[model samples]
Target: MSRIVERVRRVRFTWTHLAALVIALLVAAPLYWMAVSSFKGKDEIGANPPTVFADHPTWDNYREAFADNNFGTYLLNSVLVSVIATILVLSLSSFAGYALARLPLRGKAPIMVALLMISLFPTIALAAPLFLLMRDVGWLNSYQGLIIVYTALNVPFAVWILRNFFLGIPKEMEEVAWVDGASPVRTVLTVILPQARPGMFTAAIFTFTACWTEFLIALTLNTADRYRTMPVGLALFGSQFTVPYGTIFAAATVSVLPIALLVLVFRRAVVSGLTAGAVKG
Candidate 1:
């Protein structure tokens, strides 16, 4: 019986590993194809057979991508908007979350539910109203406009996540801060926030990712080339009659670099934050 159980366990482990490998390949295949396509020339990219491997890999695609479009400008815009949006969302959400978690407030549950419901509505639904509002406020084609929209879009999730995470933290810490004559603001900044790093990290990462990849809002808000983010700028690679596959692939590969770097740098923090939040709350 013992031998049989051990054999079954080994078999299960083998199957699990195989399943994981297959899933990883599926997830990675599109990215792998994009990277490979970026290295290929236009002719090779548009080959009849759709070659998996480039026959003659060249740097022309990347060169043409930069030469054809304002790639640098787009990249800078995306970085700025994403960073600012992330900061604002995190700051505002943290304050809201702390209040909801610690303060004596009426209708907190209903407020949270309402926020969640609002977030559930599709972005497309809000696009028209938002565009009108931004235009009226003379915020069109502005970094601040995009940042404000992104922050508003992401805050609900941040509040929900951070609020629960805050609740998991011991209230005794805040009590100690109060006993030390710390005001609510001072207690939040010094005592509570330090302990809530994981939640904040998680919220920041989510907000940044959302803002970085957001295309529709950016496109609608910013008609000017200077204000366009990577997603919108990428759309300009293809012409009216024909698509530039090589340039598109190359541009996409470049656009992914910042997000890839972010993941590499913050993987540990993200994992820890997610795990802590999940377990604690």
Candidate 2:
């Protein structure tokens, strides 16, 4: 009986491993193709349906991409906006989430419902009004403008995520802190915040990625080349007359690398953040 159970377990493990391998390949194929194509010349990229492997890889595409576009400026702008937005979202959302989850504030339920409702509102719906508002504030084409917009857009979701996390925390822990003469703010800062790192990290990663890849708002808000983010600036590589596929691919590959690295580095935290509340609840 034990041998049969062991055999069944081994079979299940084998199938699970195979499934994971297949899924990984499916997810990685496009990124791998993009990286490979980035190394190939334009002619090679345009050949028939395109080949997975490059016969003659060249750095010429990268060189052209750097020379043609102010990639540095675009990268800087994206980083700035993403970083600022992530920080703001993390700070504001965590506090709001904690208060909603732990504090006995009046009309809290209605307020949270309002926040969730705002989250459901489409970005396009707000674009016209946001554009007008930004224009009046002279924030068009500015990093601060994009940062504020992105932070506001991401905050509601962040609040919900962190609120769930906060709810998962044992109330006894904060009560103990309170009994020890820690004020509410101090208890939150020293006790709750440390425990909430996983949630904060998750929020930061999501906010950063959203801001980094936000093309529509950036394109609409910032017409000037100087303030354009990577997504908008990289589009310039493809023209009506001739598209530089290799260079475009190279730029895209590079653009995704930072985000990929960030995810890899904080994968554990992300997983914990996502699952902690769910499991606890």
Candidate 3:
């Protein structure tokens, strides 16, 4: 009877693995095709139907993407915006989250409700006002402008996520530190912040991804080729008359690789953050 039960469990596990594999393939197929097409010639890419592998793979597309388009500049812009925005979100949100979780401020409940409410509001609705504000501050077509907007947009969500994680931490640990004569700020930095590393990483990853893929605001604000980010740059890659699919795919692959690497490197942290939040609640 035990052997039969074990066999049934093994069979169930095998089926689960098989299902996951199929799902993964379904999701990855388009990305794989884009990568394959990036290496293929224009003629081969547009050939009847589509070939799985390039018959004559070439690095020409990547080279052309680099040379023709200011890909380097756009990549630099993306890196700058994403890094700055992530840093600002992490710093501000962590502080705000810590306060919301630990501090006994008046009207805290209402304030948190307001933040959550504002977070749910459509970003598109705020775009026009944000654009006008940027213009007034002479921040349009500037990296600083995009970074500020992205950071502000991302902070509310970050604060909510981090606050929940902070609330899960045992108060005993902080109290012990305080009893030992550590100041509140010292206790937070030395005790709580380190403990909340996983949540912080999760917030940073989400913020960076949001900024990296942001299009509407980036396009609307920075019309100049010099100030354009990767998304905007990719949008302008192909004209109506002529489309360079290979170059576009190559650029996209380049853009996605960094995000992929970031996920791969910090996947453990992201999982921990998610599971910790779930367990806390």
Candidate 2: clashing pairs of residues: none
- Best of the candidates, lDDT: 3
Q: After superposing candidate 1 on the true structure, give the runs of residues whose Cα lies further than 4 Å from its correct spot.
A: 1-8, 279-281
Quantify all predictions' global Cα lDDT against the true fold: 0.88, 0.89, 0.91
RMSD for each of the candidates: 1.9, 1.9, 1.7
Report the lDDT tens digits of candidate 2 across residue range 205-233: 98899899988888878989999999999
TM-score of each: 0.92, 0.93, 0.94
Candidate 1 residue 109 Cα shift, in angstroms, is 1.1
| Model 3 lDDT at residue 64 | 84
Give per-residue CA lDDT, model 1, range 166-239, as digits (tens): 88889899899899999999998999889888788878888888898999899899999989999999988777
If ranked by lDDT, best first, what sequence of candidates would result? 3, 2, 1
Q: Give lDDT: candidate 3, residue 42.
A: 90
Locate the minimum summed-lDDT window of 10 residues in model 2.
272-281
